[model samples]
Target: MAAEANADAVLAELEALSARLTEVEAYLHIEEARGRVTELEEASAAPGFWDDAEAARAYMAELAQVKGDVGLVDRAHERLSDARAALELADEMGQDGAEFIAEAAAAAEELTRAIDEMELSSWFTGEFDHGSAILSIKPGQGGLEAQDWTFMLFKMYMKYFARRGWKVTVNDCPAAEVIGIDRATITVEGKDAFGMLRAEAGVHRLVRISPTDAKKRRQTTFAGVEVIPVLPDDIEIEVAPDDIRVDVYHASGPGGQGVNTTDSAVRVTHIPTGIVVTCQNERSQIQNKAACMQILKARLYELELEKRAETLDEIRGPKTEIGFGNQIRSYVLYPYQMVKDLRSGVETSNVDSVLEDGDLDPFIIGYHRWATEQAE
Candidate 1:
């Protein structure tokens, strides 16, 4: 039955897909990534490559990503070769080769999906859109409930990252005043992490019976989510020493045994913008300071983009621009359990699936499609 599923037509479609894959590889810079992988590998093998541990880690991460990009194209080419061989084998085996034809058809269909996803990359036109992302969530006006909301948002994103098979590091997630976290800082590393997560920027409002509230009354809380690309080494943003204040303190949260004992955590305050960034994830004060500066630069870069953008929404992304009046999405767990995106009008009645299970892809994709249409 599988062999009768137009194996010749499927093979022909796969042949056409081979040409499409080549074009996709060129657009995605697969050859350039292959070269970069070779260069980075040689650099990593050199002596003293790990002298500055943080920079070395960054380089190695880039190396891994470059190799992955190159390997994807390589694997696609291999699949095409395998499909061709299968088709030939099926022809040679006559009626006994149904399984080979079925397998070839399946490979073609899978490769088609992969190529379409890669082609969608063209929608991300921003300079740093393809890079890794820094995720930050800060509580708004909901007080204790807002703090709790902040923690919940952090967990939701963590779950989403896990589902996407992305590597994540908790840069900072200190305990809040009474209930939740002060804020959440996470570094997410994956293919197009910045591009995909930028949809989550801005304000998220949650309405529910506050677990922290004694009255158990319905409460409305807001938390602002910030997403910015992890800048490449070439894109340098300078920070003048005179324009910032540095504070060092004992590292807090779950950073291992001696983390809290030493005053290793570094916090930098950009005096002009009043933007504050903290890094206690690293034990060494210098390393923490470096991480703090990197975060500061990303924030400043975002600020610069905000300056250039005619409308704040263009830079902030498809969501609302981080304010009480401008909540991007609402998660209602009260009288009715519904999660909805205010901008895209994508809504779902099952709040549990969204909040607990991290089923956020529909909303994200919906907004991006809307945004792309608007651009057109």
Candidate 2:
């Protein structure tokens, strides 16, 4: 590859990668990030910094992410400069410099990939987009099939979350009386978890031969996927404690001795907003209530954001819902086998790969790419 390597083309690619890296760095405000890092470091070192656990965590996470971005840009710049110098050196030398040219070509490819990832990260500029997320899945229409479909959707997201290396906490997932689950809510903790998952915040439809049907008839089911960024305790919410209600209930599911015996599950309801959150995964009512509060706060924060901005409609559409004809994506298995994202115009015949193994990058990346164009 070295003997036939076009050094000029390789150099051009490296230059473009370098320019893109600079653009990402600028968009991320690396200089401002460095200043913010210094401020955060000083504050963290002061007395009682860790007194508020959630706020300290948020502050530390931001500092770490900013530092990482700055480091990534710094290394990418060095790689670009080195690759350019290698090409120049190869040009000055004779055929003996072919190896250097080949090395620079490889570096160019690597830098391209790294810069592309950085560019994607730069798109998550929202307040909580870079943070973790609260995700909920509820079966819509189709009765028993809908319940089963809810579990399928939950499994698909579990696979997707595993692929993304996000830590997921199943705050609640109660099985239906006969088939799948009544509802499933999870907390996804990872960098850009909310930003990426928000792509799936809408209705998903699945059509297939119903396993619950004795006649093997085809059935269509719908499930709603809600994604909201995890609200940090530092952010003041619009609700008051007086306007909220808390209830405890015995946890329901296939469980152990202490699990189903007592009222360990907690439900939180915001009266004014009519937002309800439930958590039953923990055996302790207090822990479950905490989880419910976390999810509730996220929902409340999302509601507040809705009133102030229009950009959320890009991800969630205009009053999009979980019902017939409102699906953002469709998975067909009976007449034809395919998984399609209506918003991104991305589809594939590999239904098993999507529903089973969780190959979701195409749809997620495609949605962002499409959204970027619509914005432009």
The top-ranked prediction according to TM-score is 2
Whose lDDT is greatest here?
A: 2
Q: lDDT of all the models against the reference?
A: 0.83, 0.84
lDDT of 1 by residue, 131-182 (tens): 8999999988888788889988888888899988999977888887577788
What is the TM-score (0 to 1) of candidate 2? 0.78
- In terms of lDDT, model 2 sits at 0.84
Considering summed lDDT, which 10 consecutive residues are worst modelled in model 2? 252-261
lDDT of predicted model 1: 0.83
**How many residue pairs clash in each candidate at the backbone level?**
0, 0
Q: Which stretches of candidate 1 lie over 4 Å from their true place?
A: 1-116, 254-259, 310-314, 318-324
Give RMSD to native, each candidate.
Answer: 5.7, 4.5
Q: Which tens-of-lDDT digit does each residue in 133-157 have in candidate 2?
A: 8888898888988888988888999
